[model samples]
Target chain A: MNTKAFEKLNYTLSLLSAANGDKHHGCIINSLHQVTASYPAKFTVTVNKDHETYQAIKASGSFSVTLLAADCPEGLIDCFGYRSGRVKDKFAEYAVKTDGMGNPYLMEHMVARISCKVVDSLDIGSYMLLVGEVTESEVLGDGPVLTLQEFTNRGKTTPPAATVYRTMAGNGFRCTVCGYIYEGESLPADYVCPICRAPASKFVKQD
Target chain B: MNTKAFEKLNYTLSLLSAANGDKHHGCIINSLHQVTASYPAKFTVTVNKDHETYQAIKASGSFSVTLLAADCPEGLIDCFGYRSGRVKDKFAEYAVKTDGMGNPYLMEHMVARISCKVVDSLDIGSYMLLVGEVTESEVLGDGPVLTLQEFTNRGKTTPPAATVYRTMAGNGFRCTVCGYIYEGESLPADYVCPICRAPASKFVKQD
Candidate 1:
């Protein structure tokens, strides 16, 4: 559907976490955005209905957002984003603080922390869009906050099975050493990164 | 509500425009954001119900998005934002060209041009949330695409009567010549911009 065109819209990457009683969950999300800009500022986040994070947010009616830094370590993303929060205590390994409702917001490799109370929500097919009125917020540090394009430029790819997302047409190898993803029909035996000049041996094929 | 805390959630600025037959409309919007990243990359935009631009998007079922440049002129914001689209033809005075859908996207002071077809919508109180599947997009230039924090740092102020946006706490003076707003209970007679170095003599009371 000429979906490659969709790559033009840019967004910041963040983690949305929530707690319900003793159960707490978080997930990676690129869809967090501001809706209203005045006092009681509003934000909307879209989540897959089946995720444990979604369950926590729906039950608690509140969530915490941590804005990731540009140099955010891979371990943090793997812990909070790639792994399921229901399986373990995601905050156990990290430095953190709790909000009034006891939801955890990261204090490491993060630029800001925000707490919000869900004021409205909508069901959209496989997902639920939660609109929250920010209850408390604080800037943790300076930025440029990491962006979706920068994530891709760093060679991080989203699995198509998970989202209705669109990337540059075709697929190929990613230079894992530098996060410079190379898209093509096939990988050359001796190819190297245009940016980092790394060798083909460092490239991994896109799944 | 200690809304000053809400300053932590920052956003990018862009222009959302659509064509309805021979009529066209565009408005300054900071709420456009990606909702998904794959296939038909999807985005959501929140629009005030009363704006002509919203009516045009609904009637046309499509819209053009222009990611504006960091150095976007004050005149452009005044024309598309401060003025009502129903009252005048905004593009008549701006440099622009038509996209594949025969829709006009700005050519000057833009980082990219994107065309989208509305896929879904929801009524959210005073605003409508439009979901758009991007149909075509192309980079227009290099960017540090403008961020909301930069907009305010450049001296732009949100009208308190508008959306639920948050800014620095307390009330103070603004340097009229530079658009640099100074916040506090009162203005100092010897104050000067840490940026432009404009003196307090140029500062005016905040409304």
Candidate 2:
């Protein structure tokens, strides 16, 4: 696989966030696009079906997209992206505000916050494509949005796992959703990932 | 409407190109994403239903995505993005090469080129969602990919009109796909947009 070639396809990364009452969930997403030019502006967001943010948006029919800036703190990604909403309240750890519609958007290190209402959705095998119309939008900061290339160049390899962070921890399983390494003698049936809260079914044995 | 907010959501843009035999088409698309992690890698690209590239991909069941670089020539965008395949052969004007499958991939200032075969599709009102599995991917150059913010800051406003080049002609109808302004008497019913090759029906009168 031409892994480096794939990295060259730089894309703007964002935090797809949604809230169902006090339950706020957010996840890092690389696939999003503006579908129309204002006048009930539309946008499309694609997410892995197993992701907690996907479940939150599906239940609420509303979500907020916070465009992460180049200067965004690493802690923000660790809290909202590395940790799952099912086990942790990401908003509690960060300074954020809820819109009138109840979606919590990050207040720090973000360039803009756009609120949306889902008008339609499509199911692809492992992901769901949500089509939504922008209800409200606001500029939060003047910093440039972060691109995948910049993120990679900054030595921040997020997702499935950061190759540099692990030290071959003795044939353990890694969480596919949050990249949490679990070291154990045998896979337990009732075990759930501590970092992303994904079930045992979502863990893949380390090579 | 917070117009400036949209600018904050800077995304990397690319030209989606496809060919069936000698019949080729390419169009500008901002919405594309990797659906799965490698191994018969999957991707989804959303394109307007009216776009010629959409018909070409639907017919050929294959396509190529070229990640335009920061230094990509303006003529490339003007030719592929601004013009349609129905009016003329865009590939004829540029120096391009074909892959093993005979798909035309731009050899110019592109960061990477990915070839895919369409696996599934969905209708999303104004656009079609094409799901394709990556067959091949190669890095064309080490140049940085172009993002929407950089393109805007470079003063390259792609459509409706180029903000820097135009003299603001009075009461002109602009091609919706490409920003070519027709400055003349009542638009002829048979008039086709020279820039984008869109019909008179696709023109929207300037405000």
True contacts kept of 2: 0.44
Q: What's the distance in Å from true for residue A28, model 1?
A: 2.8
CAPRI band of model 2? Answer: acceptable
- Using all chains and alpha carbons, the TM-scores for the candidates as numbered come to 0.72, 0.85
Interface RMSD of 1: 3.6
Q: lDDT tens digits, residues B39-62, model 1?
A: 346678888766678888888888
Residue B161 deviation, candidate 2, in Å? 13
lDDT of 2 by residue, A49-68 (tens): 77778788888998998888
Residue ranges of candidate 2 with Cα displaced over 4 Å: A37-39, A159-173, A181-192, A205-207, B38-40, B159-174, B177-191, B205-207
Report the poorest 10 consecutive residues by lDDT, candidate 1 chain B. B159-168
lDDT of 1: 0.69
Give residue A20's lDDT in candidate 2 (0 to 100). 67
Model 1 chain B TM at 0.76
